[model samples]
Target: MTKEAGRGHALLVGAGILCSRLFGLVRQRVFSHYFGLSDAADIFSAALRVPNFLQNLFGEGVLSASFIPVYARLLAQHKQEEADRLAGAIAAALALIIAVIVALGVLATPYLLWAIAPGYTGEKRELTILIVRILFPGTGILVWSAWCLGILNSHHKFFLSYVAPVVWNLSMILTMLFFRHRDADRLIVYLAWGTVLGCLLQFLVQLGPVLKLVPGMRLKLDLHSLHVRQVGGSFLGVAIGRGVVQISAFIDQAIATLLGSGAIAGMTTASSINLLPVSLFGMAISASELPTLSRMAGDEWSADVATKLSARLNHGLERIAFFIVPSSMAFFALGNVVVAALYQSGAFTRKDSYYVWAILAGSGVGLLASTFGRLYASTYYAMRDTRTPLRFAIVRLVFTVALGLASALLLPRALDIPLQWGAVGLTASAGVAGWIEFHLLRRKLNKRIGATGVSVAMMVKLWSAAGLAVLVACMVEHYLPLYGPIVTAIFVLSTYGMVYFGVTYLMRIKVCVEVLGKMMRRIGIGG
Candidate 1:
């Protein structure tokens, strides 16, 4: 694998994620237009998540955190054969594991759907199970696509793996467009089959690039390889951590199921939007840093090694905060506009936009903490200590479930909070738990290597600029004449961004200053 230390790789990955996320937004828009936030959409949304439990527990999160580091280290040490062998063995194992999981999931779709959404009944419940069965094999195929992502990221081929999922998104969009009136039930079934085909295509697209990086890497049942065993050890720990996280998500869905019609679909739409910033900023930087950090992990511990790790950690956090802070602000202040611009068409209404925005606002609350938490978790993996993250993930899950139950389930009735507010409660509660997780990760990281991450002043400036942006956005929203949703969004967002950058410049935010200065110089402007 190749390791490059530069902002360019991170930018490339971020740009790819940006493109993929845009396509993902389109995918959701198509769904909203065709299915709206009805029980059919609810059925599909909740069912989609059930099979993803397999993907979450066994897919990218575990493989990237565990396998990539080790594989990248082997390549750095000029042990290409060992890296190839490890990749092959892990691939073989996942193939076997995913095949079994999919088969069982297909057979047990009813139980799975019930666990995911116990409130579903009659036709809704039956439809959810049927769609889940169609989606299971596809989910299994996509889990292996995470395998492709692991291989590509190890080799600094970040762009393709991140963007390739656009194919999957497009598949769904096309299905809906073609069969937009095929009765909601049959349309959802067609949609599920489209998803399966898309997953197959998404995985195949990456195989060529992966083979280019690791030649002759055919699958081998070589669990006996020492390197394979090492990856397996790391995989088990990371998988447990991912499983707990998935359980938290599952809990949210199960609770949403009880909340009433449209709750599951509403939250699902908002969550896809919420993930945009996390994937673009958080995943981009963390993925770019992994290959380099993996090599550092293989090095002998010393004062210099510790210094390098801390410096890398701090710099990565700086980049993460810059983009994510503004994203949180936009979601909090202009979520309805955002949702309306993207999704208010056909069956989706202005009311649906507000409902989705409410959840988006709540998600914004913990956006920074959750994103920063990803870097901290990656830091632990780089240090070869997956147990700490697993431990904290368990704590986070407990907090998430408790808070989720109190706010999302109980408070809505006891306190007379609206049903929409119940969805907000779910997202906001997760944000609170995210802060707890971030705090624990930071404390452990500080104990491991003195102090790490960005300075207090930098954080304050980020919050201040974002706060200022919100006020400006509010003023714009209040004063500006109404227009079409998309146009209104463009006008407000463009103004908010200009005002934000202008204020950040005045505040002398160092990351903004430096990145913009470099852009100016690159374009032949004054120094």
Candidate 2:
């Protein structure tokens, strides 16, 4: 794809994701208003993790890595008949698997709480089990929705797949609003039922577009087909990689449970805020580039092919870093403002906002590395090298587990700090692990595809400008008598954004200049 085409597609993906994420934030804000850091909040958080495991395992990342490349390449070769068969086979097989998994998950909910939320007891544990069972079928439906995403993305239909989640978020939001007067335990059960309904709606919305794209689609098991086998092979590796990552997340939650009452809920809330940039920029660029990269793959690794791939990868890295740099800085310096703005009403207190801010700040440590690692992983997927990423992911998980234990369990007590601070340690340690994984992925890919990454000088410029923006925003917050979270965030964060764009424009960063110029022209201010 041309650079302009690639940027345009990435922007489309970003717009869709932004809409979904904004609604998701609204959902979380409503959730906080109802439950805050109470026991009910912790139960919901823990229960949701169980079903999310199913979705993450069989969902977007897994499908993108394993399904998209092979399927997209068939389309690039104009083999629509074969592509349809491949899609049909995978869809049939995925449905069968999801049905079995959901049934077993519901039956095993009591058992799962032992591993996932070992700290809970009596009523809390029983309620968690109930919620997990209620959510299992819904999460299975979401896994099916991911299959739709793979089909849509391979056909280069980006927006609807990403935006479909808005319905899912809206369902939960409205459920909470309708039952806002109810107690937490009963209201949460209603929310789970709402999630299930939303899951169906999310899939139905995508099914229409998918059917249009693949009119010849038919459902059948075709394990005998070579392309089907290829997808299966890649699927296993990606699944294992995704499983390792999930285990790491679960371990974090398990550790959080040991920390204290509010720890799990606090971490979950912080993670919601932390994931914004990752979903918006990291996932967007990678998702947009995957098909183009897959289509560009040559039969042989010739110099021309390597150079083309490296050029695309480097440009993607640059785009991610430009946005993520400022996001990381803002999280580190002004996270409390962000947390307050998004989720500090009703039961969520000023104290809870600060607690989440600490975790968000810790998350900023490896934001750039983690985002860059995602693009690098996508490049590997495009090259049909799924195992390399799986290996690196396992390594990252080990570091995460080891470092996480030390930082979260031991460090706080050693420092004579409150145990609640252990949650921040968990995020910071995970950030360190993310950097390690990123280094390995980049180093290995560079050897295979030649040198590819954002330039050091480019990073220096981004960081410098972002640092200045944060400094100015902080100074403004300090000097001005900001009254409320919404007003303060609007004024201060807007100032930070303006300063970052102004500095980058003055520095003649190509992307920044182009974006600013476009904005100016739209407003009738520039040539």
Candidate 3:
């Protein structure tokens, strides 16, 4: 693809992702307003956890990481037959695996609920079991959707792929609104079914273009293909890594369950809020860059691949820093107002906002680190070096376990802090783990591709902009009542953005220049 095409693709994806994230924030507001850190919300969030965890482990996390690179390589080499065969084989295997897992989840709902949230013994546990069963089949739908998306991405049909999540979010919002008045607890079950429905739609939407690109695309079971084996190994590694990450969350939820009825819900809501920026900017860039990196790798253009990958990485980091840093600072400075504006209606109370904001602030510290880690980890995958990331992921998992244990056994007494801060420890652990992973990936890339593959100067400028934005945001927060939380949020965001852009441009940051140049060309204002 030409640079123009790449920039267009990234813009389309970035814009779509921002829309999806906006809808997601609205969904969270709905949840917060109706549930308000209650037992019902806690049970619902906990129940959704297992299915969502499995979806990530088997569907998005493993399948996309494993399938995209190999599929891209096969398409590049004109091995369409092999790519189709491999896709069919993997899809068939995933079908069987998802089926068995769903069955097991249904049968073991009692035991699974017990192991994950042992503190819930009465109605909460029963409701959780029912909700988990309702959501379990969503894993199957999502797995199929991931396979379809992998095919579409490999074919460089990215627009619809980016739009699919918006569809999913919109459907869930509609479902929640439809059922909000009738037993809000039961609405979660409806949301789960909506998830399945959304996945089906997402999969079918991408199928037309994929079939056009790979004329021989078929749904068949062929387990003996050699290419399937290669994809399978990468898939297994990714599954392990993703499973470890999920385990960390599981541990936190279990610990929170023991603390209080609303603890799990509070932490989950805060986490969902924190993940918004990460998904919009970090994951969007990683997804957009993967195909390009795979094509570069397939062509044996290591120098060009390294340069392009580093440029994209630096750009992603700067963009994320530009937005996330100020957002984080604003959340910390105006935690209550932000929460009140978004989620203070219905059952949500001032107390609940305070607790949730505390969790959000803790999560914000880790958010940037984790986002950067995702960008760096993709570099390793683009180089076809999954083993190194796997090793780093294992070490990160160890840190999670150690930190979880510390939080469970020693943290409460040693710090004299309340139990609600349990998630705080988990977030800190993840932040530390992300920092380690970034440094390791950076060192490895430097060794393999030389020092130029890392962009130190651009990062310095990004950090400078972030620091200035924070200072400006703090001043705005102090001086402005703005009369409303939404208005204040807008003021803070717009002010930070203007200052950040103006300063970065004055400093002549190359990435800013490139982004502005692209914008100018798009507007037919400059060549």
- Clash number by candidate, in order: 0, 0, 0
lDDT per residue (tens digit) for residues 40-158 in model 1: 99999998999888888888888999999889888888889888888888899998998888898899888777778899999889888889999999999988999999999888888
Better candidate number, 2 or 3, judged by lDDT:
2
Q: List candidate 1 stretches off by more than 4 Å.
A: 1-4, 521-527
Tens digits of per-residue lDDT, candidate 2, 1-527, equal 79899988898899999999999999999999889999999989989999999999998899988999999988988999999999999999899999999999999988888888888899999999999999999999998889999999888899999999999999999999999888889999999999999999999999988998887889999999999999999999999999999999999888888888888999889889888999999999999999999888744678889889999999999889989999999999999999999999999999999999999999899898889998999999888888999999999999999999999989999999998899999999999999999999999989877998888899899999999999999998998785899999998999999999999989999889877887889899978
- Regions of candidate 2 where Cα sits further than 4 Å from its true position: 524-527
Clashes in model 1: which pairs? none
Runs of candidate 3 exceeding 4 Å displacement:
2-4, 299-337, 407-409, 452-460, 520-527
Pick by lDDT: which candidate is best? 2
Candidate 3 TM-score over all chains jointly: 0.91
Flag clash pairs in model 2. none
Q: What is candidate 2's CA lDDT for residue 144?
A: 83
For candidate 3, lDDT tens digit of each residue in 1-527? 66566666666767767776777778788877778888888887888787887788887656778889888889888998888888777877888888998898789889887779988988778878888888788656877777877887777766677677777777777888888887876777787788677767767777677678767756687757767777887888778877877776787777778876678887787777777778767777777777777676664756776676666656556665655655666556556656767776678887887877877776776676677777777766767677887777777777767777676546866888876667666666666666676677677877666552335676667667767876787698789976676777677767877787778888987656777777789899976
Q: What is the TM-score of each candidate against the true structure?
A: 0.97, 0.99, 0.91
lDDT of 2: 0.92
Q: Which candidate is the best by TM-score?
A: 2
User: What lDDT does each candidate get?
Assistant: 0.89, 0.92, 0.74
